[model samples]
Target chain A: MNLLHYLRALRGIATRELLRFVHQRERFISALVRPLVWLFIFAAGFRSTLGLSPIPPYETYILYEEYITPGLIGMIQLFNGMQSSLSMVYDREMGNMRTLLISPLPRWFLLVAKLLAGTLVSILQAYAFLLVAWVYDVRTPLEGYLDLLPALLLSGLMLGALGLLLSSFIEQLENFAGVMNFVIFPMFFMSTALYPLWKLQESSDLLHTLAEYNPFSQAVELIRFALYGQFNIYACVYTLSSLILFLSAAVIGYNPSKGMMQKKGGKQ
Target chain B: MIQSIAPVLSVQNISLAYGEKLALDNVSFSVHSGECRILLGPNGAGKSSLFSLITRLYDTRQGSIDIAGLNLKRHSSKALGRLGVVFQQPTLDMDLSVERNLFYHADLHGLGRKQAKDRIQEELERQAMFERRHEKVRQLNGGHRRRVEIARALLHKPDLLLLDEPTVGLDMPSRKAIVEYVHQLTADHKIAVLWATHLVDEIFETDQLIVLHKGTIRFQGSVPQLLDTTATSSVASAFQHLTKEVR
Candidate 1:
């Protein structure tokens, strides 16, 4: 209704999310550990096996860890997005979601606020991943850390929206693990998260195009460039548009009159 | 009791279906200030479905719902602003303290900080939950948690309290306490109540009743009128007589 109400609601929702994140120590540790595993073992193993050419974000050849840092950052956001939506599905089953939906605020505003809060939390995880990576010698320009804030937020928003969209379609929390595997593995492997588009092209033309076109790859590129204090207009625009598209679809999927809630309520 | 005043909640001709199966059909009811309207029904009698429509968890397809003179579809914020709901299931985040839950709900209703704190204290104190405010909801028993939820629902001082089977799983004393508390709300304060339940023992002499069965209203009137029509001496027999007719 009033600005004060809207602001307070957003604050409460966001704070709830933070409190949940803090309470789930295993989740926070696992979120960071998943990415750290790749940096310590996966990248360390690939340092000699994988070769790299100079990329837009880099002036000279870089090691595998350096190359995968941005991708790993992307990985953190990607997982955080899905995991937050996973919690949403869990909440719906538990009825906390009903408490939220019944509030006087517009549904769209609530969903957006939810998406934003999830994205912010994911951004925090990404920074944590970045911090660990930086100490591990995956260093970039100091200003890169500051400049990449907007990029991470946008990328996190897009990924979180995608997760929110998937959550709306999922009926049971039990069905979500399979869906996450189906989505996460393909989206991660097909993108430039593990390797560059050129490397994919060297292996196969089709894989090249898929990686090049993948939204996750664009997100990776955006992070990579921004980490070096550089700008890539194409990646920025692509990620932003993907954010809009996914967010709009998520909003639609959550609409009570037309969306998933219209199904019979033998269970709410 | 403010029986002469306009109804705080009015539902007119609300219908709902899931594809081919009708969940609720042509359901209409109203709740005036100081009135407690009980929606009595069997398990599959579409009680949850109707509550969903009222809470806007799902919207009505065939009719309109108005709360405090505001149409729910067009003016949802204003309409919902007048409603407080405690769902069939416990909805408080188990990880968050009781105070946090109430504060979050108050914020959603636009209560200012000092005002929200005051109201939270008042409602919690009323429910005998103020001493346990800082405890996580998980620490409370089923009855205590329900009390906290009731306190949270009242933070905004809504005109209509919509409770969906709030005492379904509680022990006898807890159930009696909740029933007494809610009845006192309508008796002392002018707030209206729409309580959905299958438990015949929970009904009071002053309470109005709606007997719903298989997606339709079987009967709607005061307890005496229900007794006259069903020719039953007690609430239990009357409920069984009304519900078992079509079966």
Candidate 2:
């Protein structure tokens, strides 16, 4: 395909995703509501009990809600990422994916278009949640907003790629709930989304080690630092590498010859 | 001397398997422009598998496939670009309007906005759905939805059109309508058609037919030739006789 055609395909696919998101108003509401509830109810409940030593970016101690704001943004994107994969599973079952796969574009290009589209949606959700947080008095510096853009995009891509990788392995929509329980919940809970790495270390060495290696933790840390206009190189490298690994796995899984979807005994 | 036109679709020695169970064994066929080739088979006869191979939904381990002279393996984009497909399942985005669905397909094919709009208008009008173009696909009946899908497939102006059981679940009139429309597409547009179905009534005596059974081609020839070989008066009886003999 020519450049114009590639651009058109990207625009069409992305616009379709946006249109689907718009029609499903409840999805937007619930995506925003889930984190806000955590920001308000969970954070408020834990605020008094939790104590923090001044972390590097902060000169003084921070409120629990303020500390967890970036994590909540990551949470919003993580859920949206999985939700997009759920739609992909539905698309496969409904045969819409076949139509997409039949497009003249290279399969990888098509997948990248889909991943980018999902990431765009997640970014929109992240910004909306940030706006709500700002209104609720969990304010970040003005420059931090600009810095958060790239972090939000990278984090979104990482989580979205993970979702794509999972979707490629998941054959049926009926089994997605199990994945949500086993994968989503574990990835969210085991990561530093809810607590700092130091807190996990204080609790258990094993848990701390797990959190330290978690890609989701890397993503949350990336966003957390970016929200304060700070760059975390370790988190950046970790998240970028994870994005490439998961995305390559997803692309392979969707390959008709060698991927997970390939029929055994079929020509490789 | 007249020069022969190349076949729009050519599948040679294509084989597929699902682990130990063979789905297709050394299947081969070709369809030329303006020809309607019916891949007639009963359920589990590897009709879908063959369609999948031709459409590149699955790869061929043993053979090669070419679309409008473009090698599928070596020039996938060009090969795929020359063909349009309608799968056995309904593929329309139910939430999108009929027009939007066609528009999306046109965009996927790289058609510009103006050209896509014009082609969408023409196809919808041709399908007698122009009046309802703005309606969501979910609002349309099965036949209309199938028609919309056909329109979407044709927006790219493919030289070959692959339809896998395009009339599976429709009423008799709807089924008849789709069959006739596709036949008309072959004749009027000179589009090669590979239509896979198990229904005996869908086959016409003049059309090319390939009888597939249990992952192999039981017969490949004109419908009349099939009857001649099976010593049966009708295509249905011939189909039964051939498949039974193979078993």
Candidate 3:
């Protein structure tokens, strides 16, 4: 339980994750391609056709590409979190996770270390994506860059925790593709990923309410507010509360006594 | 063995199940410091399941497990600290050098860089892997990779070591070398060993043997005691005779 001890463990976990990113050169590049494809290809096609009312935060006419920059960053965090969790499940199947599980550390500490490690990687990807956006003229406040770190870290942790929770219950790794279709796509698209929640309200009242209450929407708004150099109390509260809830669920899901992972004797 | 040796680990009537499917039923065994106990069983005989329960990789619904007089459930991290386990599969990273692989493990155990460096050197030397420490595991032979795993397990100086099918893919000589090395550790360092495997050849005459079948302990005793009445002389032949008779 020593602080130095767990910090060392956290470093190991983070280093291991970074190594995976290094070895799989193609995977590292492909992770960026998915979000860019959504930005460059899909967003470009929809920019002229989509009608936009004035966004509250927008002082002037903002390009759709600039408006969606925060959402794309959120997209990168969300997918990267799921991919990290998928890798964990893959490790469980491949026996690497057993190495972590069998370590002589408290399970809760191990869980937190893993979450922080994954979140660190997710934030790295998000920053890299933001750099690409900057070149493309997707402008935000100069100080916005400094303010976005905590928002990105919290959103990454919350999404990673949710992914970890799902991993504990996922029957098999093959089911992960199904989860992308069911859990991830809906969470991203049904939220304010491409447009504001208020903008969705013009289309359908039911969709607006769903978007307003969505945890994913809260994450997007938190990051969006931070990206614009503004503080939104409700978004910050919602993001932090969801982070706590998801992290608690993830910890409980990995509990050796009751978690679905406890069934160790079944076929690997 | 010490003149007055105490048991390093004790398991009493531990039974485990998955819903209604029983995985281990009333399993009990013990090993004193400096002793080696071999678990001989066929597939689905609960050898791996027993390892899982002992390591607390999974919890048990029934019975108690104590390591160095501490209950496993009450002081899991403390109890687990005394245990070093080599799984049935290769768990080391293929891309990382042997040293880096062990370094990652040392960090997980919370050892400082200097301390971990010293321990890693000592352990790799103990397993005769120091020469190959800088080589990526993928470049090494299967036998050498397993040696790296053994070295990794020993980094923390665990009191009890559990190896589940540790020599699954190694050649005969490599397997024998590992077996002899572990035997030497038990004698020289007074470390307890739980070596689980289906191959009865892994069980030496001096070692205690447990025969697990269908999630139950079919037999447990010294190799001599188990084979004394049989006409066969080797542990493998004795196992064949006993299991055949039971069947």
lDDT of each residue in A9-82, candidate 3, tens digit only: 98998898787677878766877787888778888898997766667556677777877878888888888889
**2 or 3: which has the higher DockQ?**
3
Top model number, TM-score: 1
| TM value for model 2 | 0.97
What digit string (tens of lDDT, one per residue) describes model 2 on residues B114-185? 999999999989989999999999999999999999998999999999999999889999899899999999
Off by over 4 Å in 3: A263-265, B1-4, B229-232, B245-247
Candidate 3's docking class is medium
The collision pairs in model 3 are: none
Q: Sorted on DockQ, highest at the top, how do the candidates line up? A: 1, 3, 2
TM value for model 1 = 0.98
Candidate 3, number of clashes:
0
Candidate structures ordered by lDDT, highest first: 1, 2, 3
List RMSD in Å for every model shown. 1.3, 2.0, 1.8
Ten residues in a row with the worst lDDT in model 1 chain A? Answer: A259-268
B-chain TM-score of model 3 = 0.94
